[model samples]
Target: MQANIGTIDRALRVVAGILLIALSLFGVIGLWGWIGVVPLATGLFSFCPAYRLLGLSTCKRCQ
Candidate 1:
């Protein structure tokens, strides 16, 4: 799939994902922290199925 996520969006996702996973590892959060993987994967792939389904794109070119 084409990259629908922009640089800033991807960076934020990566950061948020890392923080969530770190909190989980440190026992600061419950298993829900594992949910961070979703953002991490989408960030790396630069494609969000939800965004597609909603007809949204963050990439400048895509717009």
Candidate 2:
């Protein structure tokens, strides 16, 4: 599969994921906060199935 995510987007995902996980861990937020796992996974993997299905790409160099 092609890489469709941009560097800045990936970086934001990673940062948001970390924040969500941290808040969830602290019990200040609900379990739903753990949903950050999605961004975390996608950020690490550098691929988003939804983006692929929707024909959306944020890559700087798409071909």
Candidate 3:
């Protein structure tokens, strides 16, 4: 699939995901922290299913 997520967006997602997972590992949250993988994977791939379904794109001209 074409990339709809930009570098900044992906970076944010990765940061958010890492934070969520870290919180879980540190006992700051429960199993919900595992959900962090969603953002992590999407960030790494620079594509999001929800974005695709909604026809959204965050990629700039650089992409």
Candidate 4:
């Protein structure tokens, strides 16, 4: 799929995802934090299914 996530967005997602996962692993948050995997995967892949569904894209290059 084409990359619909921008550099900044991707970076933020990765950071947030990592933070959530870390918190979960450290028992600082509930297992729900494991959901961070979604953002992590999307960020790494630079593709967001929701964005695609909504016909939105944060990457200017894609426009």
- The segments of candidate 3 whose C-alpha lies over 4 angstroms from its true place after superposition are none
Supply the global lDDT for candidate 2: 0.88
Backbone clashes, candidate 4 = 0
Single out the weakest 10-residue window by summed lDDT for candidate 3: 54-63
Cα error of candidate 4 at position 43, Å: 0.4
Model 4 lDDT per residue over 1-63, tens place: 999999999999999999999999999998989999999999999999999999999999998
Q: Could you say which candidate leads in lDDT?
A: 4
What's the lDDT of the predicted structure labeled candidate 3?
Answer: 0.91
Model 1, residue 19: displacement in angstroms?
0.6
lDDT of 3 by residue, 1-63 (tens): 788899899999999999999999999998899899999999999889999999788988535
- Estimated TM-score for each candidate: 0.93, 0.91, 0.91, 0.97
Measured on C-alpha atoms, candidate 4 has an lDDT of 0.96
Q: lDDT per residue, candidate 2, 1-63, as tens digits?
A: 778888998999899998999899999897988999999988888888999999988887864
After TM-score superposition, the amount by which residue 12's alpha carbon in candidate 3 deviates from its true location, in angstroms, is 0.5
lDDT score of residue 24 within candidate 3: 95
Clashing pairs in 4: none
Model 2 deviation from the true structure expressed as Cα RMSD, one decimal place: 1.0
On TM-score, the leading prediction is: 4
